[model samples]
Target: MLKVQEIRELIKLIDESHIDEFSYETNGTKVSMKKNGGQIITETPTETKPATPQKPQPVQEEELKPQEEVVEKKDQETAAEQSSNYDQEITSPMVGTFYQSPSPDQGAYVQVGDQVKQDSVVCIVEAMKLFNEIEAEVSGEVVEILVKDGELVEYGQPMFRVKTV
Candidate 1:
């Protein structure tokens, strides 16, 4: 069986790499992890002997917590959608720190309400000391900046929302 720290390290390594799915099994223990929509899901199914069938019972109060969390997440998503009137977005291509300007003393590349061409460089994402300029893939007006300067961004995270022409 893998220790908690070992599992955490494994997850970090997998997230930093391009691999999507990983699995390991030994001595009847199984561990599996997969990336879905940029979220890592882990499963460790144990081997147990089959039990005699029994009558079903109502779910306990504790069992309802997960359902409540799901509902809360849905509500948050709906609120965000209502707040932003955008047709497109500029997403971070990798996990990194978001930068609004080329340098600390320089002005931001683009601000809210700025018009952008398809090839316009709107921001930069620095990963592993490499600064990568992120472009606007669609001609549009910048409707929102989703992340703040120097904030850590996840891969595929939307950095800017645009109203496309």
Candidate 2:
């Protein structure tokens, strides 16, 4: 259960952050909040008791390690396979609305077949009213633009694929 002060702090943090919705559940208590325009709407906390007492599951550290290693190995292999298809990818550094140009009237920073050097501004990501310039970290030619202008992008989401020189 969260205290009133803790809940208020959570609300304030969420309001300041890029998160549009938040939900937390613990010990049968659930709290949900959503943002509408600039207002934060918080749902009344709900508390429910379990119909039956449940036994806690026992865990072995030894059992967890192998599974974790296997999952990590698989993820690495999948990432390698994807990266092999493109020399490099320009990915969003934060969750925000992706904009290809500085403004509606301006030309896009980069497009397919465009050559870019490291530190070249490739796009902008607007979060919490701040427009952050996204850079191409690798020197390359833009082979594909993965995201459309004005689209909502998630952290680490690929925005462009570049063929490194």
Candidate 3:
């Protein structure tokens, strides 16, 4: 559970800093905060109140059997697919509008299945009126292009998946 002091500190940081978003994860708790157009949005785990003492009612066990079976099957399926191939995720270095090419008429810097060097320009991210070229940090073949051209992207958001050479 989050303490009152911690929540106060988070609010203070958001109010004082220029950062638009913040996320924190600890143990099983996750908190995500976003500031959009002067509005602050916070997402945290829901807290459940303790049930008060009341007259006990008879419970039906038969109705829960089918739900339990479905949940078990889903868990097995998830476990079976747990060993799927892992690809290197290319995340945005900054918050900006993502562009696939230098100019509208120009071809994209990279596409799926294209080979890229460590310094290769993968795409461009326009931030605060400045167009910054983004590079592939690792030498690899592009396995996926996760963002569309001219789409707005947040800082640290995954923009591509590159299978390292």
Candidate 4:
């Protein structure tokens, strides 16, 4: 079994790295961690091939809070969709900090109601200290901006919503 500090370090490494799944096993104890969207889930499953796998223990109520947050976030997105179903989004391709403009001195790359084409540059996403320019893949008019400037965004997070002509 890993020490508490060692396990925390592993979690930090996972948060910083691009790898989505990782597991550590030693002396018949295994710890698995997985990332979904921007959330990390840690699971420890005991191996019991020699004996009927003891019915998995029930998760405590405290362990269920994170799942509740995921559900709430989904409901919030649903509410946003209901406000404007015609709005199609351009989501972030990677997890990073979103930048609306190229630099501090410049204004935003695209604003609401601005017309755009498939190849139009919309914003930038900074990941691992690298600035990546984001492009719109669908031609339309920008209907809404889902994220704030300089906000940390997760993979597939909606950055811009457009209304197709």
The candidate maximizing TM-score is: 1
Instruction: Give lDDT tens digits, candidate 4, residues 85-138.
Output: 445788886778999999999999999889999889899899789787888878
lDDT of 2 by residue, 15-130 (tens): 68888889999989887877663432322211122223332212354578799999999999987876765798888766789999999999999988999998799998998897
TM-score per prediction, in order, is: 0.60, 0.51, 0.53, 0.57
- Supply the TM-score for candidate 4: 0.57
For every candidate structure, what is the RMSD over all alpha carbons to the true structure, in angstroms?
11.6, 13.4, 11.9, 12.7
Model 1 collision count: 0
lDDT of 3 by residue, 17-127 (tens): 898889988877776777673533321211132234521311233567788899999988964563243257777866789999999999999999999987788998997
Kindly report which residue pairs in candidate 3 clash with one another.
Answer: none
Model 4, position 97: C-alpha lDDT score = 99
lDDT of 1 by residue, 1-165 (tens): 654335546767886888889998877877677777343232222113222352122234348779989999998997688556888878876678999999999999999999999789999888779787877878989988989999999877889989988
Model 2's TM-score against the true structure: 0.51
Clashing pairs in 4: none
Candidate 1 vs candidate 4: the TM-score winner is 1
Off by over 4 Å in 1: 1-84
Q: Which residue window of length 10 is worst by lDDT in model 1?
A: 42-51
Sorted by TM-score (best first), the order is 1, 4, 3, 2
